[model samples]
Target: MLDQAQMRYFEGNYQACFELCLKGLEVVDENLKEKFVELAALSALKLEIPQALEFCAQSYHWHKNSYFWTLNLAKALIIQQNYAEAIKLLNAFMGVENPLKLEYLHALLRAYKGQNTYNEVENIYAILLKNNPNDLQLWLEFGEYFEFIPKKALGIYQDCYFFINQKLQALEKNTPKIEVLQTFAQDSLTARFNMQKTQKTLIENPEILNLKNFVNTILTQRIAESYLRIFESPLQEAQKAAQILYSVQDKNLQNAEFWFIFAHALEYIKDYAQAEQAYRYIFAIPNAPKNIANTAAFHLAYLLMRQERFKEGLEFYENRLAFAKNTTFSQEYYQIAKNAFLQDSKVFTNKEIFVYCEQGFGDTLMFSRVFEVLCKIAKKVLFAPQSALYPLFSAKLSKENCFANLEILDRIPQDFDFALPLTSLPLFLGLDTLEKIVTLKTPIISPTNKRKSRKIKRIGFFWHTDFALKENNTRNFSLEFFLNFLLELENVKLVSLQVGDFVLPECVENAGVGFKDWLDTYKVMENLDGVVGIDSSPAHLALICGIPTLVILQPRFDWRFGLYEAPKAKFYGENAHLFVSNPNDFSTKNTIIEKLKSIF
Candidate 1:
């Protein structure tokens, strides 16, 4: 039964595995209890919380003193959002003298940290340090825990600094690989310690030149490892580094590496104009590698696009494609060029449309608005990824179009007038402004009813779950945050207009009118008084539907949303509002709340 449950879990039958674990827990022998614990842990990981919790309770009852069972119970409780109980169980497990006690303690500390129980977390660290006095990493971890707490950080910093310094001093003159690994571990801890300390200090004193120099030295010494650390640290450090580098008299200091760092710093500071100039400088280097040049051009083009200088951006993208080393980058450049052309009227006419699929199905769906315009203007439209999307497009667009793979393009039709990429339809259609092209006519809500809601303002909300390529997991705001925002609003009915396999919040799901299809979402959106979301298909759909839409954008967002030039995007013209958080400071939760309030 246990083997079958494990196999079912591996096969993605989470519901079946969860049920099996519950059935196994009924016969509570030692082996069955162990199996129940393992299956419960697996079920918790699979997000089947009810069954996980049930099995976990049975496991704890069978072996109350077992740390593994208690840990699994804690994990299941955490999954069920019973953090208080989870923390209690974790604390019980932490009292054990086993090797895994430290790991359990760490998990408890993390749980307490997530709940903002800073004192509890500090207590755990202090206890851990007393138990393992020789563990340098523990000292560093404690420092990291206090890094954001201004009042408590000083003591933590001093402890980590001393521990790491002592380890560094003890390093032998001739060390083996094992010793080197130990040294590296200490160095990493030290790096993190300095980074956090310097960040806190920089926040308080932005013009600390000496501290800036110290950070720069560390960054230069550990270039690769320090990149992410420096990049994510306080913006003031990068600004100070850029200022120090800019003030240097030596011409040799203006190398690709220096300029790239400077550009990154400027970008972090939201000085897009200066970042643009820095990228241009990199592009002008006499013997710059193709990859570097291509990158510079891409950034330059992206900045230009953000500034709404579509003509210049299109030119730069063309240059990028001409010299691009990687096929993927070249393809991306081509797609950008095509999209830029769709927005600019100057280059829309007499162009042959070449449609190549890029990114994901959702992106392709969002950009498919260009296809209708292309069919009307282009002499011939050639679509790639012919086998997959051809039938779909054919059903949507009942026109004579050529669909072929890249390899079969040798036999060009002689009478073709002009060729343009599919994404270039906006530029080709001469729709420079969103107001100029986007029709305000809302989609008909029902078969015989075209009336708007009279009592309440219909607000459409879309939360995206398709950011697979995004690095930061926090980019996807919790459903709790959205629910909090919705609960505070007045005279508004919040409708979930999201698509794909998004896990809707309990608040949203329990609101009674849950949708199961895109058609239903679209129909609801068509009658909305206003719409708001991140950069997703529904946001685009609301824009196309001519509803007033607000896009809550990330600070350093994708170039497609025009990140560099227009801080407030003009994507959907005056009807569309873009609200961006401060990149330097991540404490904009209140700012977002206030913005939503103002809108309401």
Candidate 2:
């Protein structure tokens, strides 16, 4: 029996070995106490916890002062996650009267803290403080622990800092007067107390000076680490910072650095009025860097554009062109000149409209609509980057529409009539009323197989190209959203009348009806039931085609969506239906779906 028990124990068969040992103890009691203790420890190690605990109890009963058996029981309780019971057993083993009892007490306190028993932790801390009243580190730790616990421990941190300061003051060889020390401590305490109170009040009303100072200190000290992070803060927080900086009395703080932040903050809030004012402040500053001034001028023009003051905005661009040196505003100046021409009734008597390619192939293609209009007034010459657009334009436009156009070259035309950039069509044509322009009556194409079988509704689809803009940041909707809507609708044979390289959605693609050029796209648009897309060239093309178009506008976009009033008459003309959503509205998907349903 002994041999079997030994074998089982060696093989780590704890239950079997424990059972055999118990049976052996029942049969014979010679030298059994030591054997029981060893078996209990082994069983506990094997995690046969209940049996091990019972054995420990028996061993402790036989030898009342056996600390080893008591410790084994405590360890078993700890392994079972009964920390409180384990602490009690450890305390009993340490015998409260022992000199090393404090060590075990500290361990119990740590165990309570590890379990997040804050009250127990505080009680133990209180005991330790009572025992060692002069330990400064302990006092500081206690103060730190109490920092977040409301009014109950409000003075602890002050007291800790005061005591530490006093100790340092005492160590000085030139001892200050008792009155000075007392005054300093009192002042320190008052300052700390007032800081907490002011912080609360500032959070409640951020415009206050004390709160502003606190925020400025944090922002300025951490600016190198947190400049971008500060820009990314909530618009309200950034606005508060901007306001504080605006009100600063320091001349150095009122420079472009401060105004740039202020401008961005106002921009984020869509406070274009205030943002324009801030940008102007930066522009007015003497000796401002060329890039900064140019940016300010650009943004100011953008604001004016948003407000539909296109003439005034173009003037700002012209001013930048005149004054700002070595900047991109020169290109922008060309754009503004064209915009001014398009929007106003300013006659271009022999003026050369210089059409240089600005953004993309599709963009150049769309803006080429200006050539037809310009040909009526000015000696038109296109300075484009793409050779492909040249042939496309030649094929699409007639002899009268084509001016003495030269190839894309590095130098400007020495002898020309008044010049206007291509994208400035909106300005040159005075984009006011749809009824004024002559509409094309010719059918874009003959009936195809897809159009012959079904009663076609002439639905137009434009899944805007991802690469059409700098990033997807500019385009508003995804392919799936449009495709899903098209797939569910009936009685509508959708046509891809989209201009640009923007991929058509799967439904449009699978229908095998897509256009590759602006001519073909506009031709297809002329036959569509209606045009549907986020802000894109097709929307413009449809408007020009005199067809009904539904434009899904993003929040706070260009004034083309008609921010000033419903029917945004100044931008998209009266015929366009503008579908817009607010920033706070989370139901954009549902709104789009409903709008599509109504159109279908």
Candidate 3:
């Protein structure tokens, strides 16, 4: 009965085998109790039965000396997330040289990882590699441990590919022996029989096929992802990733993950057309991973928007809501949830809406106009503005008296029908056309005081602005370079718009001292002739207030800026002077310098 049950399991009929094993365990002889229990436990695990862990525990309890059952019990504990017990059990077997040493190390790895002791996980990985240096699977496991920290993982994945390829080459070299037998088949019947048998044997060897799959599918994914992460060499690394991904069999056509990465690589390499096609392919797959598909949609939309295809881009942008969370913009950075946010095209007539602030101070200020638009549609609008700008928003919204339904809150409210990030308002309103979307105009914040007539012109200037983003450093130029250029101008008094512990020269008037809020900055900005700064909130404020604004944008500016060389952004319409700083083109900064001279 045990042999029959084992045969059923081997034949892939786990349900039948599970039933047989469960029935056999009740009537099995004591002399054969371990075999029946072990078989039942293995079958239960395959079928994912609740009793799998119980059976394993029972087997191990009966025969504590059995290494096989001990390993099984440890595995059960790990699966149930009882990491301490699993770690204790695995740790006991570590010193001895046993047949299941690798399995034991991996169990320890899982337990350590569950406990978040990454140092212990790394130690286990080091030991695994030291003992099994030539194993590609071990290298793959090591690479996955540093998934977010790609810089550390890239080398490990590359090494895995090297070893996997070597194994593949060895397999290819041995193939000629079978061919030799086939070549001499006409000379003898025995040669023909030998050739046929050898072919059958080779076909049955799943190890070689599995090794090739490691190179083609999983390894390709790891290596390409790592290549895409290298920021310094975006174009170069993206090209390499595209090359490696392209080399995969079947062109990775049916694989959503493959197509997603391929699309990103195409975008990086500036092949917009193929990138668009690759992104579209993932959307066609009905069963594609929700996160991967949504990400593909985002990249596709961004790619189109970069090329001035606004309506098409906006359509794709809406697809991202399928995976968006019902949370704050700041929480959206770290939180991932399924399509819980509003995406079903539900109308909000007579419904209370919860609008949360997203991104940064500049982004919040930029998107705050949407609240007024939202107020008209929803019966009651509960707006949670950024904490820093809460006082100013409360004050300003009160003065406008635009909507009796709108209420600004310093913190997130408990009751709301639906929620959205302020930036996502355009998509919710079905404003697919760029013309319908709101732009920064003086209406949002009219000048508090008209510009005073003076012999000397006052211009707001800032050389440093930090958003805590990865690409923020590239947006900043040398302060000395800015100071030298500014001090050279005649009849121009520079007012430092610098905030947060910035030291300014005596020649430049300090304007950001003891600032209560953005309203204080707005009061000072309203009196200035013009404002010039790197991509920052003050620049947004200046544009919205109808002040002449000169913004020095880095080459990798925000998506809102549109084309690289455009004189003005479509959204920052009022008094916008945007110049992209391209290091390759020396004239980029020189042009800004010329604009500064004229503005000052």
Candidate 4:
């Protein structure tokens, strides 16, 4: 039990360690009581429990001969704001003529600070820091001590910069840097803030005489970072930091850590051009850690890709390597593609090429038009598309359509020269520019489901995708959001192309329950005047069939939809309309409703 408690304490599980130590005290021997009391007190202090003072007092009382126990009790007294008792105990302990770590003297400084006694504080701190020049703990505590007093901390940071630089270098080169960064990335927040005046105040201060040189340069960066971490709330603090960084041009741009913070600030404010430039610069920095550089490289393309500049950004999309490890590559297929992925522009010319669909059915449908171009480039094309899409493609590309070389297959052949994803088609097809790629081919225009007689135009829409396809339901929504806009229109028949178990209003005719696969949905889509949906296969199929489809998306939508800036989809062409849904931006919803009214 004592061993378990000790292990928990060392592992930094303070609550668990404190609880285990309590249980241990009941069973431990007299000699072992000291360890129990020590772990319990230290863990309690970390947990910020009131019992920390009680346990610390007991530990100090029972272990009167120990140097560290005296310090622990003093720490508890300082935390409890018993400034006189803490000062008396610390001074007596210091008078014992025993050598101590710089961190131990910092406890005395803490006691002095509690009483607002600054007379000896600066002199003691400077002497200790000068003597213990290499003490990391002293430097960290010193930084923490004067957090709000940015000027004092800035002076110390400048004085002991060699030691600070060494510690930074060690942390930067740590083997676990990537894992650490990955962990920090799991939670993120956003808020609005402005820190321009802080810079103005720091510059204009008359008392900041000698500090002016550093303040205008490194000290400017230091002051901005100083009080940020004393939290007001996560979002507000995050904004304060980004806003603070925005006005901080004196920052060392060469530092990986500085670049990381600066780049994120640029992104938070939607200054994507500068953010992309910063990320690219970080990626090219030779001195930056590989993990940091790779992280910058990973997000470098998103700035452009998210803005619909895939032509310039596709080759730089390394996010697959950094975040979506499983989706990025499977060990089985990575083996083949790693060496032979689209070997040459004419690699498919008079040769057998294997094309597989790996992304969602919507992505497949969006990129499927390139397959016909693939057929034209190759003597024989071995296509392994989604099974649900097989019947539609096989029928569409039959001998009658003159696609005799294209073969839709259930199993990929072993003899194909090279393998590639359907999404990667443009890279090898020599459609090197975004313009050529978007216009690769028009969507499959089918003649079958066209309604000859049109009176009240029938419109089909679905607002959901397979739950597994979208994380956090970003691509799914309650059909009720659109019901107001959709149903309000005059001379329109609402048809639900939605599948699965869904509740629909009585006014909506449920056409989705009849669909077994995308082929069924495609057939149904042809009979409608148009379709509306989130980024799902049904909408992609509707758009591909050259039906006027309104793809309702969130502001930060799929790479295919581009952004709301231009509000045009060059690749999906004029038959397709993109509407990025933001609850605050009702103009888009109004536009979509007006577009629906015109169709009738």
Q: Top TM-score: which candidate number?
A: 3
Which runs in model 1 stand beyond 4 Å of their true positions? 1-257, 319-354, 359-373, 380-420, 424-451, 465-475, 497-507, 510-524, 527-529, 558-566, 582-600
Instruction: Identify the leading candidate in terms of lDDT.
Output: 3
Candidate 2: C-alpha lDDT: 0.54
Task: Report every candidate's CA lDDT.
Answer: 0.56, 0.54, 0.72, 0.66
lDDT of 1 by residue, 1-600 (tens): 888888888898887887787678787777577776667666765774566777678767877887777877787777677889889777665555766787687768767877888888888898888888566556656755664543255456445446444544444222211311212343476556654322211122222333334334422322221232332443454455456545541443436656665666576567878888788888777787767677677667766766667766756654544543353234554555556655774453555545555344444445555555555555555555323334334333332232221111322334333443434444445545445444422111112223253557767776555563333211334445565566567776677765545556543532215554444455566566777677665666556545667777655555656643355645445556777643334365566556655553
Q: Would you estimate the TM-scores of all the predictions?
A: 0.48, 0.47, 0.61, 0.55
For model 4, residues 72-189, the per-residue Cα lDDT tens digits are 8888988899978977877776766666545467887877888877656776777787887665456656665776565567556655555545555555455212321112222333
Q: Per-residue alpha-carbon lDDT of model 2 for 49-160, expressed as tens digits?
A: 6556666666667666665556656555555667788777777756445554555556566557556788877887777767875565566566556544423343443444
lDDT string for model 3 (362-428, tens) is 8777766666667767889888777777776676654455566788788878887767777667666
After superposition, the stretches of candidate 3 with alpha carbons farther than 4 Å from their true spots are: 1-130, 141-153, 175-201, 249-251, 307-312, 319-362, 371-382, 398-407, 411-421, 428-430, 438-443, 448-539, 547-556, 563-568, 579-592, 598-600
Ranking by TM-score: 3, 4, 1, 2
Q: Which portions of model 4 show Cα errors greater than 4 Å?
A: 1-270, 285-299, 305-310, 318-345, 395-402, 442-447, 466-477, 584-590
If candidate 4 were superposed on the true structure by all CA atoms, what would the RMSD be? 16.6
Better of 1 and 3 by TM-score: 3
**Distance from true position, residue 86, model 1, in Å?**
30
Q: lDDT score, residue 269, model 4?
A: 43
